[model samples]
Each structure stands twice: as structure tokens, then as C-alpha cells.
Target: MQPVVHIGAGAPGARIRWGPSPRAFGSGLALFALLAVGCSEPVPPTVTEPKPPGLESEPRWLTFKCVKPGCDETLDVTIRQVGARKLAIKRVVLSEPDRTEYSIESELSAPAIVNEQFKVSVRYRPIGGPVKGDVKLLVTYTDASPEEGEGRIPPGEVSVPLLRRLVGEPVLVASPARLVFGAVSPGESRSLPLTVSNAGSGNSSLVISAVDSDEPTIGAQALPALGLAPGSSTEVQMGYAPQAAAYSEARLLVRSAGDMVAPVEVLAVGTSLPDPTVAALPAEGLDFGRVEKGTQKRASIEVVNRGGAPLELESVRVVGNANLAATLPNEATSLTLAPLESVEVMVWLSSETSGDIDAYVELTTNDPSARLFSVPVVGMVTAPHAVAPGSIDFGKVPKGWVLTRPITVQNEGWGELEVKGLTLVLGSSDLFTLRSLPSLPLSLERHQKLGLEVEFRAEAMGPFQATLSVETNDPGGRFLEVPIRATGSTCAEGCPLENAVPSCVGNECSIASCESGWFDTDGEPENGCECSEIGNDPGSSCQEAHYLGEFPDDGTSQTFRGILPWKNDVDTVTFFAKDAFNWGADRYDVRISLASADPSIRLCVYWHETGNHLSECYLENENCPESRSFQRTGTGGGDDADYVVKIYREPGAAPTCKPYTLSVSNG
Candidate 1:
């Protein structure tokens, strides 16, 4: 049995945003003071109430200055009323005819003052210090009260400061805090749309600026020197041109005119895209030689990072709706791989079932070439009770017509696939001639298949069971056979020719033959027999077992281990190593061989939950002198998640109690 592994997949904590946005805080405060504010009382009115018991207040001011030069000026202003009944000001003269506008608003539920030149005093309710909103005022004089006048206080305008952090076209969200681009190509220039949002509740224009450290190679540019307001964001592609030098790595920085001192960084890395880029994994159509269904084959591919920087592979995944799984061993888990370094991940794309199906592997490394890499698969398993349909039903043909069918051979076993030569059995020696197609190359990929065409022709009428003898490089090939049927026909006038081989050349006939073998026949011996419930009989029952334990070491890292595929052995499996250092398991290769009581059947071992193939142990396929070579693999840095292993049986194969051995050493 293969090891079963499970991991945590979600974050463990949560919190809410309660911090006010800096841009929003500043802008909102200004808006609050401006719309509901009034100028100081006129003629220096004397204050009379120095002891209002229970009323507490503090002073704050609102300011709005366009930080541009040459527009420097003050404004004439006075309190139309001493106290707020709706605070109002008159004589609002513009410092520059172009700079002043009459704008004022009142606090919530506040009344309006109706005086002209700013009255001296009036009893007014002290608006709670928290008063806020935009106000309206009319220009009493086109000229702003001269800023040159001594002791002169210039009236200022107040409104929300439009955020100018970062953004294009849309000034609202001028900059982005995070930017992500996946799988970019060489010399590809992508315009990355960016936006800086005022995450606050106030109105602020967004301002954005881009700074490129790797100029030209990886740089930034923007329209509208200024930014945007809150809630608005612009879309722009980040233009990227990877130089031959950039064939390695690249970076871009964008700066915002905000509190952020360091600019946000954008990175570009090179990739080893497949020769022919594919959005998904493709089937290479391989030959698994010839094994059985319910078996597994193991293979590996390199995950090389061709760029200069480190690669963060969130996972090395297998993506088919099927439960087949693949993974990067712990050493490769969430690896931060340096440039040019490759990590080998284990892949299992075939199931323990049968069919001409496909398994997709989703390699989750952000390699610029191919972010998501897929290894194509072709071979699947054939039914346990059935052989590949390699026969041609070319019904009765005109004496010399030939029909053909191509059949694929697949090896889905955990062991070697043996393709013994084909034997031409005379299912119809007198009526038909059967010949194998030209010697065809038949090297199948693991779980992969190879197709062969068989031609059939008839010369006379007869019953046929084209016996196809499959000679295999596989040791147990003699036990398995393929059968092809080629029924032939010859018809003559009303001779009432029935089983003499008939095609639709004449009328159809419904005939039934009855034969009883319990009694002796006058001139025939029974070739086929049928029996009905002769006596009480029972069918075989199956059972499930679980194994979870530690691995044992025998030799150095060069040693091996063994266990049985049945009950007692199924509960425990162990492998040996050269040394005791857990980390050094990387130096050893672990091979586990499967042996069964039935030499005609094979045992299959794979990861239970993920269906990941670990190894294939043949029943009697391997016998050197007196033993078999156990398949080895390292559960390096093996732990609870990586150390356990499992073994099961292929369909049509009987369960055995023979012990399977595991060989360990470094490859």
C-alpha cells in the first residue's frame, strides 16, 4: 500500500479592518470643517459668557491651499453672526478673481444667519466640536482681501483632498497595492492596468507615478501626471519586453505620491514553456508495454526554474477529474527553488481500473515558460475479464476480400510489460487465412497503448476461433492469450445450407440446436457442456486490510525491506537504509517487490487517497536465481506523511500470502 497523506488547506485566523484610511481621514476632516464653518466675529466683539457650566469645546481649523506657487493670497472674511444659528460670513472677497467662489453649507439641523456685513454678535448654540459638511458663500468682492495687509487672516477653502496615489484615466483608484501577472512570454509586452483606491469613505483624487529599476527591460509609464479619487480604478497592462539577458529575470517598481516611501515591486521571470505551448496537458500516447489493469507505473519529470530568481511552487499537482494524484516530496514541497535547479515530483496518471482513458497532471510551478505543465498520457487498462478487441467482423466476403482491425496493447501493471510474439492459430484453417500485420513496433508507455492492425480473409465456409498466441518478453506471458473470431460462409440453392457459413447473400433463418450430454450420443462426443446447479456451491469473498507503521533499516542506505501482501504482512511494511540520519534518507533508494501465491496474478501498490502509484510487484515476473529485483524509491525525510506504504491485487488475480520485499539504496 502506498502512503496516505493529507494536509491543512486554509488560513487559521481572521480580523476586520477598523483603521481609517489616511487619505480618507485627512480629506474627510477638511470637508467637515469647510461646509459648516464661519469666520471670526467682527469689530472684536467682547465675550460675556466665561462660565457656561457643562459645555466643553476645543478649537480646530480647516485649511485648503492649492500647494501651487503664484496663487498665494488671503481672503476677506467675517462672522455674519457671533454664534451659530447656521454660521454665516459675508464680505468674502476673492484673493484672485479666478481663485474665489461663494460656497458654504450648514451643520446638520443648524439654522442660517441672515445678516449682511457680518454682524458683531448673536447668541448661538455651540455646535458640538464634531460638526461637519460643505458650506456655500457668495463673493462680496471680486478681489481677495490683500494678503499684504498686516494681522490679516485669509479665508481658506476646504474640501476633501482627492487622493492621488496611483491610477490611470480613472483618477479614483490610482494605484494598486498588489499586482499579479501569470505565465508571460519572452519579449512579450503586456500593459498592466493599475489602480490606487481611496479605501476610505471620503472623496480623494488618485495620483500615481511609476519608477522602474530595470528600465526598458522592465519599466513603468503612466498617463495623467496626477491621480484619481476613491472607489475609481483604471485598467492598464504592464508592458513587458524580456531581453535575451532578461531571459533570466526582470523587475519594475511603481511609486505613489502617498505615505509609502518604498515603491511597490513588480517582478518578471523567464520560463521553459513547452516547445508547443498548451493551455492544458496533452497525452504523449506512450506504450506501457503490456501489463494488466489495476496496476500502476511510476515516472518522473524535471521541474526546472530557468530564470535567475527563486521559484515558489505552491504545489506540483495532478489535475484530472479522476482521483489520480502527483506530488513534490517534502524536500520539494513549497520549494523556493533557485534558478536552474530542478525538482523531481512523483506522478501517477493512471487508475487501477480499465479503459482507454486519460489522466492530466497539473504541475503548479510558476515557470515563465509554462506556468501549468501537463504530461500527456495515452494508455489505459483493458477489462480484467476481457482482452483488447483485436478481431475484424468482416462478415462473409467475396472469396478473396480482406478486412482489418488495429488493436492497441497497453501495460498498466506495476511491473514490466511483456509483449510475447503473436501466434497464428487456425481458427479457420480451411475456410480463411489469418496473418499478422507487418512486424509493428509495440513499445507502450506506462498506462499507454500501441495499436496493431490484423487482416482477415476467407476462402471457404467454416467456424473460426482465430487463436492469437502472444509471445511476451514478460515472464508470465504463456498464461495469457488473445482470441479473434472469423466466421466464414458459402451458400448454394435450397441445399438448406445452415451452419456451413452464411452471409446475408440469402434469406435469414432462425435455427436452434438441442443437445443433452447426460446421456450417450450415437455418433458424437461432447465438446462443450452445460451444467445447472449440480450441488450447493459458494463464491469467493473479499476482505479489506489497513497498514500503518514505521520502516526498518537492514543494510546501510544500500539495504532493502520486505512484507507480505496478505493479512499479517498487510498490517506492516518495512524498508532498510545504510545510515540512521533521517535527512540522509535522500541518499537511499527503497524498492518493494510484490509476490503472490498465484503466479498468474500480480499485486498493485499505490497511494490510497490520492491513487498515486508507488510500485508494481509482479507475482513471479521476477525470479533471479531464487529472487526478484524489488522496485526501489526513497521516502527521503520520511515521516508519518511520507513513510507508510500499501499493496493490493489486480483484478482477476487471487490474493496471496507470499511476502513482498523492498530494496533500499540511493539512485
Candidate 2:
């Protein structure tokens, strides 16, 4: 017999029954008899389903739009758990070739439990040009709970790779970014050719919406509108037309549609022309009012074209009086004037007999209103004349000193001379005075004379000049001028310092500055600059280097000291190496050392005649010693070849007062 087990639905219990079977009837009947007699029914085994933890991302991929270079764009991504169990986010990072341009702005705590949803912000910033390729976002996480459902999910960390795509937009570029219309007339215009091209990466075409200008005088025009494919170009004309005489500037803005690049600005500049006009100095008229008989009086008129156009002078002449004469510039009969050009016309009057004269100067020009211009000239010839000393000089006088001189006024012509007044004119008039002048309107016959005195007082140091005017009735000598000059000095004996500039301080003579290559070492104004730095002389050169005595054969060092008197000043000295006592040794080592309190001082060694560089040394700190060693072939009894040593301040270093010492010895 065979036994079978059955589970009841109503209660948690199981029942067993036996079936007829030849193979297992013996054992089955024995097991059934024992279960039925010794044990109760076996309870049914309990069972339950397992739930695993999982993570779900809001965005599977990231996309960024870069409007222009150096523009930043930002986006956010959400992460949450979809399964029943929670997950911990370990870390988030960006990985790519151009990963530097992308950044993760959101801060995430390591091993954080994600029960709800969390957001991660990402930003993209392009530096220059077009950005290419994509970046990957790597999110690393691990299971926060233990294994479930008989180890369905392994206990370890996991990483999810997310992709980001970068798209480049269209950019506009212009050749010859600036336009210059040098000079344009008021009614004319100038244009410069410009080529516009698309410099972006992608299949998008650059479409220009409008071209605008900031100034009315400047404009831009494109041929057949503006639409260029990638790596394609179009021609444009930049124009400038000014309405007046002035400098103008404008910015031409090239606007595009849906372009990542900003509007391109092309600067346009130009200048306009000015109108043509004529002008003249002494515009009223020419007046040779009065003059002495047998004397000639001259006058001049300046004509100028003060505009942008040319001016034509058909003729310039004197037409009225027989005594009047006219002379043109360069003795030309006709003249042409360029813009802002000028010329002078000379006119004179001469007559043997005494009488009144009247004349007019005729100027024929291309001026619309004034076709023929006339300038009136009037004068009278007289017989009386006056003469006096032309000038008086007081020479150099000490300050606070006074000096006086005599002036004589005489009548030399045929008629009687009438004296009106005497006056001092122009520069430093307060320093000069007229003394013992005769009464007004005094009369004197021909060959008669009048005596007068002029005094000058020196108040300050410098040159002083003035004019003495003697008024009279003479035709040519109505106002006779005599120039007077004097110079005032601080000291009566003047400055006597050698190689020094003189100055006055507290009413005492002093030294202001010393001549080149000279210094005031003693601080004494009496002796001037007594110390002369011969090493800094302009005539000193490498050929004239100073000679330093040969090194001692007893192996003792020889020391020499000097100061760099000026910046970039080089002091060269040469010395001979003494022969060594060793009979077979033909060469010996010589050590050159330098010490200075200034770090800018440097020393160099060279062959005297050949100028070949041997060695050089520079100090890193003050008072620190630097040295160089070089081999020199020695003779038995005589000195070896001379080696040149140069001590100078390093280039681009400020001049210092510190001194340096150079020592040479045999090693």
C-alpha cells in the first residue's frame, strides 16, 4: 500500500491516506501507522515575497543651449527611488574630454538615503569659439539595505552613466571690422567694401535681419539681402556722408536671427569738407597819414583764403595818387590762393614836394559781391623832422642799484619842429623814468636841440627792456621811439664757481647744479663741484681700461675697490698673472672674487686684447661674495697676458651709492 499527504483548506493541517502499491506498501504503511498514532498533523509551511531596492532618474540625457561664447546655461536633474527599499547616493561627477566647461553645482551628501526625490543642478560655460562633443554624468550609488529574496541583488556599489549632447549655433563674423572714409565733401559720399561670413560650426545658416547705424551720416547696405551658409560669405558696403564740416563716427550693428553670437559692431569714421571764403587783415583801409618831405612811407595789407576752396586774385594795384606805388608778393601779376592760404601786398608813398595826397588801392578777385574792391589811402607830406638817439643800454647792473643817462632831441629839417610830449612805453616801464622834460608844445628852429634825462632802477634779477617815445610834429617822426635795455644781477661780481650752475637763494649767490661727471662731495657751495668721477667719463672705453698691478708671486690676494658713480656706468680694470715658481707647470689657476653691499652689482672677466669672455659672477644678496676661477698660462720670469675685469650695475637697476671690492689670487 502507498500513502499520499493532502493539505486541508479550512484549517492549517495535513491528512495522509494509503493506496495499493506493491513496491513501497511496506514502508508507507509503517510510516502512516506511526504518523497517525504518534504525531498530530503537520502544519503547512509559511511563505512571503521579497522586494528589492532600485533608483530612477528623471532625465535620461542632458541637453544644453549655448547662446554665445562666455554665456552660461543651467539645468536640473531629479533622482528618486522607485522600489520599496531606499537607496544611498554615494557621489555624482562629470567626465569627458571638455569636462572643464561643465560643472555640477548641486551639493550632495555622501551615502544619503533617498526616500523622496532629490535634484542635481548642472551648468555649462563656454570660454571661446565653438564647443564640440558631449560630456558624461557618472552617478555612483550603493544598496542601503541588506540582501532580500534569497540574495537576488548582490551587496555592492553601482554606477549609472548619463550622456550630455552639446550643440553649436550659428555665429557671424566680418572682415575688415572697421571702416574709415578719410575725407568726404559735404555733398559727396564715400564707401568701403566689407565681407560678412558665417564662422560657426553646424548646418544652420546665418540670416541677417537688419543693419542699423547709430549716426545718420553713417550707413550700411548689403547686396541681395544677407543669408550665408556655413563657411560662406556676402559683400556689404559701408558708407559715410557728412552734411557739415565735422568729424563723425558711428557703429554699424549687424543683427541676426536665432544666432548664438552677439551682434557684430563695425566702426565707421569720416570727416567732411568746409566751405570756401576769403578774409583779410586790416580790413578797414590803409592809412599813411603823415610823413616828412623827401621820405618814403610804406604800409602792408594781408589777404587770406580762410576756407576749403581756392581763391583767385586777378590783379592788385594802386590807381589814385601819382606818388603811391604797389608791390605784389614774388612780383606776380596774378595769384591763386589755396585753402587757408595768405599773401601780403606792399604799398608805399613818395613825393618831392610838400602837399596832401589821396589814393585808392584796387583789388580784383573772384568774390561774388566784391568783384572789384577799393581801399582808400590818404597822407600829407611835411617839411619839419625830428631826430634822437635810437637806443640806450645800461649794461649789467647789481640789483637795488640805479643808473641814469642823457638823451638829446634835435630838429634837423628846414621848418620849425613842435614838441608835444614824452612818455615811456611797453616792458618794464616802472623801472624806467624820464626826468627834466621841457614844457608841452615847445617850439624849436632847424638845427636846434633839447636835452633830457632817462633813469633806470634795477629791482630784480633778469633782463629788462623799454621804449622812450618822443612826440613831435614831424611828418615821419611824429612818435620817435628809442629802445632801452638793462640786466640785473644778484651779486656785483657775478658767480665764479667752476663746473656749476649759478642761482640766488636768500639774496645770496649759490650753486644750483653740477656739470656731468662732477659731484658735490664736500657739500660746500664756495668750492663748487670739487670731486670728478673719471670712471664715468663719456670718453672712457674698454681700450682705456685702468691698469691694476700684477698678482703677487707669494700667493697673496690683491684687492681693489671702487664705486659705481652712475647708472649703467662700467669700470674696467686689467691685471697680469704672475708666473708660478713650479718649473714644469706652464698653467696656473687664478681666482677672481667680488664683494658688494648692492645686489645689482655684477662682475665679468674677459681677455684684454681679444675681448673673449672668460667668466662672470652675480650676487644674490648684499654683502655675499661671488667668485670665478680661470686658468692662465704662466711664463718663468715675465707676467702672463692681461685679463680685463668689468664692474657695473645690472641693467634696469636703480643707481646706488654702495661700493664694491674685487680681489684676485692664485689658487
Candidate 3:
């Protein structure tokens, strides 16, 4: 059997025995009892803190590099420890994926102890590593005592996300390297489109920090936020405004966030053209020459644009004479014109009063040089009056025939006038009477017409004469005279022929005029007789024939001699008539002694077609003895008839022939 023995714990090489002698047992018991009383509990084991491997007592900054192509990202880190030590550290390790993708530039390993600042540098093999996952450091430390108990520091892990610096800043690429606005006009603006794109790879996000222009005339603006995605584009509008006419330039600066050391510069260039010029076609003025009163005239002026830019007309107006007016394109408002465009303006000149007419038309425009322009208009006005035919006559008519003639009086002045008294003056007042006499003091305005009528009655077989006197407020005269003459005779037997010699018929004296107003000094009938010293008087036949072309339709009159002193003394005249219609009483009228000085004269109408006497009349006979003038009217056989007027003294008791004037006329 083995015996056990106990000694003091502090004793070195203490032993326990099984079969020891009684003497040894007795001695061990005594020692054990003494040692037991003096011994105490044993002390616990010491603990130590854990730190990063090979990184303890160093600055905590850790650096990492992004190894991606075109990527220059870096990461820095600091390691630290906290809390009371309670567990033992096993090792310090990096997360699995992070450890494979990133490499630490500094020396750091597991199971390391760190009590102060240290530095650790890490590099990312791929650009995506820093942005994707977190690389963590695991710190494992123990606080355990062999003699006391198992006590250790708690396990700790720190995760740090690597920051991504992305690629080379916001790599902005402009579609066009320069901005250009071609030719521009002054007071105008031009714009062009600018495209900015981000051209970067990996996890790079681009941002446009700013866009600027150095020139005041140039401006730039971007739509939405300046930030853009990889391969994304943003548009910018660039504007240019030129103040003067010349070439211009500017610099457009663009800046982006991140690693760019300098901003992008774009050149802007433009040119400004001159403004438009306005001018009129007539360098002098528009003239509306010679316009009468109460008349209107027109003139035109052309407005032209002669510059590189548009010209605008603001307004147009007339500045002179109240009678003047103007019309222009868009007269009430404004008119816009393109380069080299033109328009015409119309001007009117009028005169309400009698005088020279003048006016000016002014135009307002947007031309730089000739802003305001004018044109002139000129004209003249004249006065007015009117005069009618000199006389009215009712031609020869048979006894008891009545004839009427109309006389038209026109007012030729600009104002109204009055016609006063009208009366008949004759050797026999009852011979001529007014039929449709206008009222005395009759009113007539400018361009107005009035008519007066006078009638002649051939009640006797003799020549008669009378005159119509009219009084009016005319500038020429207050009194006007119209002669009336005619010869009246019976339709049967024609007129009585005078017989100067008892042996010869008085008709023999109607032969050639050597027998008229001529005496043979030798008293020889065989030789040609010599003319008397007395010439034909004014009242006697010697005057040119009066035109009775339209007869009564065109009223006319003629005065001639109605006297025959010697035997067979005669006066002859001619006339043409368009128709065989009656003028007032007849188509043809023959009046002898229109002055009422002699009523014994005879009037004969001889037709050229027959070469014979058509009619003969002596208006003063029988009940017409008081009548002085003779009137006889008759119609021809056909249209366009020609007639001859033979006026002479009628053979009677009185041997001496009285010189007298006669008239042939139409109503």
C-alpha cells in the first residue's frame, strides 16, 4: 500500500507518500498541521491588451490607392481600441472580400497589439471596391489568469467604407470646341446650342460646377442641374447681342467638380451689321401741278429701305393746307420693312378757295440717318363765267303764223346771281311777245341754267323788226339785246312784185345786179352799167351767212340789208339746214327789216332743189299794220335742204326805196 504525505504549498518539490514508516508519518503530520495554519490562497494570472499586428504605437492613418485605370481614388484610415479588457485576443483580420480587393500599403497583421496611434495604407485593386463593400479590421484580445479564472477582452470589429474619388473629375466634353454666331444685326440677338457630356468610366459621377462668359454681350445658361451621369449629356444655350456694327469675340468658361485643375474654355465670335436707311424716291418733292378750284389732284411718293437691316415706318401725316390730305401704308399704325423693301404713299391736293395750292407730307421712320422726311405738293386755281349765243330769231312765217324761241342763260360764276327785268323794244311792241318769261329777279347758282322764251306773230304781209332787251346781274353788262325779225305773207299767190316801169314788169329788174344800185351815165341799155358811188351799208346785204345748221335745235340769228333803192336792187344770202322740221314755226325763217325801220321789204325763200321761190312774205299788212317786222316760216321738201334768202323793197306807191336791215335765223 502507498502512503500520502502533504507539505506547505510554498515548499518546493513537496511530495506525497503512501507506505511510509510510522516515524515519518508522525513527523509529516506535525509539519502539515503547522504549514496549514500559515498558508493563503494562490494569485490569479496577468492579462495583456491586443493590438493590430505590426501597427501598434504608430500613427493611425491608413492610405489606399484605387488601381483602376484612369481612377485616382485614395482612402485613409485610423485604428483605435476601447472598453475594459475582458476577453483574450485571437487575431486581427480584414474582411474576406475587402482583403482580396484592397491591399494595405503599411505593414499590419493579425494578433497585433495597438495602444497608440498608427498608420495603415490600403490600395484598391479595382475602382469598384471602395464604393461597393466595407473592409473591416477584427481585434481579438484576452484577459485570462491561469491561477485565478478565464477572463478576456471582448471581440471587436471596425468597418470603414473606402471613399471613391472617382475618375479624373467630371470629364466634360463639349460637342463643339467653339461657339460661333455668324452675321447679326445691331439691336438684334442670336443664340446657338451647346452640348456638354460626361465621358468617364467606372463609378465616376460628373458635376458641372459653373458656366461663365467674359463678354457682356455673350451669355450662357444650362438646363436642370449641372450634375450628369457617365456618358450622359447636358445642353446649354449660348446667346450673343451686339451693340455696335463690327466684329466681336468672347470666351465661355466651363468648370466641373473634382480633380480638374483648369476649366474648359470655349471661344465665341460674331459680327454686327449696320442698320437700315430710309429714303424717298423723289429727292426734291412731289408736285400736283395746276388744279382748278373745286378739283382734286393726286401724287405718289415711294419710300425705300437702303440698308442691311429692316426699316420701320412709325407714322405719316400732312403738315400744311387744310385742303391737303395724305394716305400711306398702315397710316394709322406702324409698317415693318425688310431689307431693300419699299412702299408708295399717295398725296392729294385740293382747293376750295381760288389761289395757289401748297402742302407738305411728313413721314416718321426708324432709319438711323433719315428718321423724318417730307414731300411737297403744289397747284393753282382759276375763276369762272359763261356767255350764251348773241341773238335769237324766229325766221320768216306766213301771215297769222306764231313762232317761239328759247334763250338759255347760264350762271358761270362760283356764286348765285339774279336776273332782273326783261322787255321787248320794237317799232311795234305788239309784234314780239314773251311766252315763257322767267320771273324777275330769278336766282341762278354756279353751273346752273335758266331759260327765257319769246314769241313772234306774223299777222301781216310785210317785213317787221323788233328787239328783246334783258337786264341781269352779269359782269359783262346789265342789259342784253336780242334782235327779232321776220317777213309774213299769204301762203297763196306768194308776194306782190313791184313794177317800176309801166311798159316792163317789175320782175325784169330781178336779173343781174348791174341793174341794182347802178346807173348808166351814157343812158345806154346795151352797155354794162356803172356802179353808183354809194357802197352797200352795214344793214344792207354784204355780211357773211350765219350758220343755221341745227335750225330750232340750235338757235341762231343773222342780220343783213333789207333795202332796195333802185329798181331791182336786191340782197341775197345762203343757209344750210339739217332737217325739214320746223324750228319754232317752220324749218326756215326769213325776216326783213329786223330793226323795224322799214316794213315794206319782202322776204323770199328759194329752194336750191327747185331753183324757184318756195315762199314770200310781207309781215306788215291788213290787221298787222302796227307790226314793224315781217316773219315767215316754212319747211323744206326733204332732209339736208339748201335755201336762198332774197330780201328787197316791195314795189309800192312810194318810188324811193328805204335802206333797211333784215335777219334770217332759227329758233
lDDT score for residue 333 of model 2: 91
Those runs of model 3 whose alpha carbons end farther than 4 Å from true positions after fitting are 1-159, 165-171, 182-190, 200-206, 223-230, 242-246, 258-262, 275-667
- Pitting candidate 2 against candidate 3, the one with the higher lDDT is 2
Tens-place lDDT per residue, model 2, 282-386, is 777777776777887788878765455567888888886788888778778998887656688888788676656677788887766567867777777657778
Rank by TM-score, highest first.
1, 3, 2
lDDT of 1 at 550: 29
1 or 2, which is superior by lDDT?
2
Residue 48's lDDT in candidate 2? 45
User: What are the lDDT figures for the candidates, one per model?
Assistant: 0.40, 0.67, 0.56
* Candidate 2 residue-wise lDDT at 638: 49
Looking at candidate 3, the ten consecutive residues that score lowest on lDDT are 495-504
Q: What order do candidates take by lDDT, descending? A: 2, 3, 1
Pick by lDDT: which candidate is best? 2
By TM-score, how accurate is candidate 2?
A: 0.21
lDDT of 3 by residue, 94-188 (tens): 66653455555434454444544334555555532133334544344443323454444334444343444455443667758877676678789
Count backbone clashes in candidate 1. Answer: 92
Worst 10 contiguous positions by lDDT, candidate 2 = 616-625
Best by TM-score: 1
